[model samples]
Target chain A: MRADYLILGNSAAGVSAAEAIRATDSCGSIVIASPEPHRVYGRPLISYLLEGKTSLERIGYKNADFYERLNIEPFLGPGYDAMRLDANAHRATFSNGTEIEYGRCLIATGSIPFTPPIEGLDEAQNVTPFLTLDNALKAQELADRARAAAHAEGRESRAIVIGAGLIGLKAAEAISHSVDRVMVLELAPRILPAVLDAEGARLLQGMLARHGIECRPGVSAQKILVDGGTAHGALLTDGTEEPCDFIVAAVGVRPNTAFAVEAGATQGRGLVCGPDLQTSLPDVYAAGDVVQVRDALDGTERPLALWPNAVRQGMIAGRHMADDPLAPVFDGSFAVNAVDFFEASLLTAGLINPPDNAEGVTCDVRIDEAAGTYAKFVVRDGKLAGYILLNRPDNAGIYTWLIEHETQLDTIDPALFDSAPLNCDFDKTMRWERLHAGYPADRNEKGFLVKRECPSAS
Target chain B: MKRIYAIEAWCLGCKRCEIACKTQHSATRDTVKALTQEQPSPTSRVQVEGDRFLSLAVNCRHCAQPKCVKGCISGAMQKDPASGLVTSDPAKCVGCRTCVSMCPFGCVQVVSVEGRDIALKCDLCTEDGCIPGEPACVAACPNGALVYWESEE
Candidate 1:
């Protein structure tokens, strides 16, 4: 088989690129294949699905008629998982023993869960990685069993989750809804070490405590204790024995880069791609969590593994694939995320923690213990480097914009940091250019907006 | 295509546009009931920032590359390819507020209604009391502060 544009992985990156391609080359004969047995759903909202905040259907990232209306053919389910890539041949081999030659290809096969070794972990029952839709289904079944056990045995069932990062805690929160108890174990000194600072994590920990979700930092599961083929409990490294009905292996994730790397895409922390999002291999591009982007803050290249970055990269790669001339350069990325646990919301961006003994870096924090609000900003070399806004939602992105633009501190108002930023905070000229005078939403010839999906509009 | 442009110099900051916006989007579409009776009182999509002394009414720019649309995790936010209008579907939004943090102009917001949290943003008065092509804010603006027009804007 052959396709003009062959896309692997149908999540954020691949789907975005397909939309972009459809917008540019209306009759490109696009082909998308993924291992998942469903349409493109929001991977970030899988926890929300477990929590009953969203449903299976509503979690879909696009309309039900998305693939149909767009005129792209999709090959879904485990049979379609790409097994090998021959970049030189411009061909890909799938698990179902089929090979497809393509004019151009995009490998967006995202991340894979990385589970740390634990004694007797494989013997444990009801252990699952919370990554894909299928895993969520398994967790939902686990939640149901625990709920049944709560009703029958009269002893509460607990969950032992390993890790205190974003994914682990979210899984804990979702499991907490049905399960009687959830205990999160993290090896770091504070929860959410990747996104929040010490104080911000402390504030978030307090919030989690109120929800009856116990978080144990500086600890990890040393062994998975099994009783008659089922997970009975876990033994912590700190010599604490805890009982549990299930275990969640939520350690972390590594990029799924085996195919790309073996096919000679130039490997680093992730697949190395340039501003056009194309790997060194000719006509082969990569995006989403599987690729690394240059850090806008520290100038280090690392996998951002964020949704917005994937979507943006996908658009750029699609434009490059379709030859959309006005595609914007991939300007690199910083750590920007917004997540909610129960009623608490956390917003973080850029370099939350400066390196040790870093010169010309200043950290400023304002705390209101009573309100459970903590706002910290890190500045380096007289430019906005990063910020953490805990329980402060108003105009948080303006700080993100400042970090992205590397705005000089002297030009900004001192009072702006004291409160919610407004458009008036900027001088008239800047305000007019950035705020009042909005970008024309439909000027097709401008920028990467030249996707040809709406042929009638053009 | 027509779009709303803020004329800051002609601004009175009277907040009439804000009130008009809230009423237009409210369930009752009546100023008194919309403010006092609604379970979750509608917020003004068009905000008059600063004060009467010096302020600018800010709303969604509906940018060509809308960060909210791109950053939305649940696919709740969408930009219509035909109309060029960026709108939020309250049903699909998980109230993650990712879009709220992605809007550089500070336009998108989260509001609670009927015991559910969803994103709230300006839909150019499409759902409520839209006056032909003009949005409620522009039609209700006392001055020419907010203009909804076309031809090189």
Candidate 2:
């Protein structure tokens, strides 16, 4: 097979790159290959699927006719394995003995769930790793069985979820309604330790407790207690045992960069890409969770495994591949997390909790423990560095924009923290310029006059 | 791409734009009846901000790169490539409010309908039987503070 652009892993990044390619090079042949048989779907909705909040048909991120409308070919299913990149020949070979020549290629294999070496895990049944649609389906089936068995025995079912990160908490939240009790065990001292501070985690833990989900931080699962070849419980490191019928390991994920590394592409935590998302090898690019991007807040490189970053990186890579002159430069990437758990909304962006010894960094925190609302801002040199909004997150994007643009706080109104930041927060002249500049003149037929206000002369 | 532009200097702060937007989006489409109806009450998507002398009517910009579209978990909030309009499908919405937190303009609103919350944003009065260039708020603005026009790219 031959194509002008070949993309691996037909998920968010791969599909985005294909769309971007089609936008610039209309007639270029684009092919997307993936081990998953289904078309591109929302990976984040898998948790919603387990909770029965959504159906498989509705989980698709793009429309069914997306590929057809974009005029891109798809090579889906598990037939393709072991992608080997030949930089010299500008081609790639699959384990099934098929080869495809490409003018440019993108590696967006995403990430795989990392299962720790817990004793008796391989021999345990009813244990699933929460990721992908297939894993969700399997977990749902096992949960249903456990529920029915509990109902038959006139009792309630229990489930144990390992890890307390975003994935683990989401899994616990999804299945909480179905199961009688869901225990979330985390080795870290607090839940969402990567993104949330200790106080933030404590607030969230209180909310989870009210909803009947037990969160045990600083605890590890030593072994999966299997009875009759079926997993029934977990032995904790604290000399305790948690009884359960099902277990979901949401510990963490590692980038799938083995193929790229084998092909001589440099790797840090993930495949190292230049500012253009190109790897060391010519004509080979990487995006999504498999690639490391520079952090905008701090001048450091890290694997930002967020969906929006993946889409943006893929678009930039695609534009570069197409040689589009107007291609937007990849500046930097940061983390943005939004989650709604049990009616409590939370949003966190950039560095929520900077290190204690960080120079010239200060923090302003507002905590309303009774109302379960917490707002904190980490500022450095009068610039908005990071923020965490809990419960009342209205206009949270303003903080995100401030952080992303590195806008100096002194330039804006001092009352920004007092209320929700709105467009009115800026000076009237700046606001007018931002709202009206480049806007087209209104047609006289609409009974309105189009007038351009000159801010410079005023 | 056609978009609604706000003239802050000309806004009267009368909030007529808000009433017009709410009435246009209502099920009745009649000013008096729509305001009186108890079931499925309409919520205005456009907001009037600032004081009397300096105020602006703000609504969804329908951005080219909408963060709400990216953060939407259910894939309900979508930006139409052809029309350049970002809209939400209520049938597919799970009322997560990810869009509410993600909109840079703070335009997306979460309204409770029959005890279930769903996101509401300016649809350019597309559902109100208005033409492409005649949004209800634009037509209702007597001061010519709001205008809808197509911009040449």
Candidate 3:
């Protein structure tokens, strides 16, 4: 069968491109072939799985009936990697050895967890990397069984979490609540070194500590030594041996750009794409964690692995692939992480004082020893720049809006935050007023202005 | 009798309805105070289901053919004569989860405060006249997905 567009990868970019194509060209056949066996599920739920906060069935982006409802065929399983694009014939090959021609194709293979080279890492048993839902469920099983056994025997179930990135921190929090102890080890000098500033990481680290998770910054896992077909613990670079029942490697992910590279497409950190997310190969596009995007803050191109960014990027890529002629809206959106750790929350977006420039507003707020929260607004030239919120983020939507819309600080009163929380009654009214400025509701239609759910309410 | 309706399209899947319902029905007024207080535990009439992609904020339709009122053995659960709202009396509620079992939409919740059980649902925040007057969830919704409508309309 011949299709107008053959999309590779599934999660964010692939499904989005399919939807975009449908929105514009209804007749063209769009096939999304994914390596994953299950439906597209949110990656963040991997940690939540450990706590049994949500089940695998609930974590999926769509149910089995979603594909049929959307009028898209999801070619599931391992045949995804076998999708061979032949630009010469304008066709793709499936592992079943079936050849399908395409007018255009998109590569959104996404990324994989980067497992650093360590001694005895490959042979180690019960050493899971938090990536797919399957791995998350496996990790949960291990944690739950270990916790039960430890409680029965009156022993502490220690779980060694390697890497202090977002995933690592989340894993630590999930396990810390159920396990005897959770120790987070990071190779970098500070937690979230790439994203948050020193102060922000410190505040988060302190918050995690209070939650009973021991965080070890500036430390590296030298080796994953196992015992009795199970992960016992790890030897740190600092010459300390920590005892543990299992290990979770949250070292981050690398874009799966082998096919793109094999096709002789322009490659940077990942598959390089133009402003339209089109790769060097004609009619071929890419987006999500797999495709490298230019930073909106600074022109330096990098891969954005966050879920929201991926979804938006995929939509843009998909629209363009389907030949939407709109002059293009929204910036080449950068990566943003709005993470909720236990009771505390963190929102990091754009460049927060890049090393080259040291000129941005720095704001801090520490609630107390147990409840420490901080806010930093990285402003450049009086316009709303990057901002980070740690520990009990309130009205993050307002700050996020300011950053996204590039709203100038002069238009609003900065003192509003001083009187009440970010989502204060006054600020909420102001926000609502700004959002629905031209068209205001005349009367209370039996309830609120509209039938919408608030973020916290969700 | 005024009725409440949840428009699924506008729902962002926030459980503020549940939270507000529990808070208003609690012994104390404050959120923290409500958490610790015992008896007459608050329960929401609404239930938020679905995924991040497409969510459905579900609640009782105040059905024309109500099954819950018939399922109630102790006569505690009844359709209020004045408002047509599903009201429950804790004093008579026997802690039976029959309401929960009978609810096709799973809108009715039986909450335990200390020990005794009480039935809860959306009573239309008629008492608290905060911010003029509105249901707590409706007032709290950022997306404006839920609202009350007149039964006659």
Query: Once superposed on the true structure, which residue ranges of model 2 sit more than 4 Å away at CA?
Result: A441-458, B114-116, B128-133
Evaluate every candidate with DockQ and list the scores.
0.51, 0.49, 0.04
lDDT of 2 by residue, A4-100 (tens): 9989888878888888899899999998988888888878778877766567887887888999999989888887654788888988888677899
Best by DockQ: 1
Per DockQ, what order, best first?
1, 2, 3
The best candidate by lDDT is: 1
lDDT of 2 at A372: 79
> What CAPRI class is candidate 2?
medium
Model 1: residues >4 Å from true position, as ranges?
A: A438-458, B128-132, B151-153
TM-score: which is higher, 1 or 3? 1
C-alpha lDDT of all candidate models, in order: 0.86, 0.83, 0.67
Q: Clashes in model 2: which pairs?
A: none
Candidate 3 share of real interface contacts? 0.00
Please give, for residues A295-350, the per-residue lDDT of candidate 1 as tens digits.
Answer: 98889988988898889889989999999988777878887899998877788999
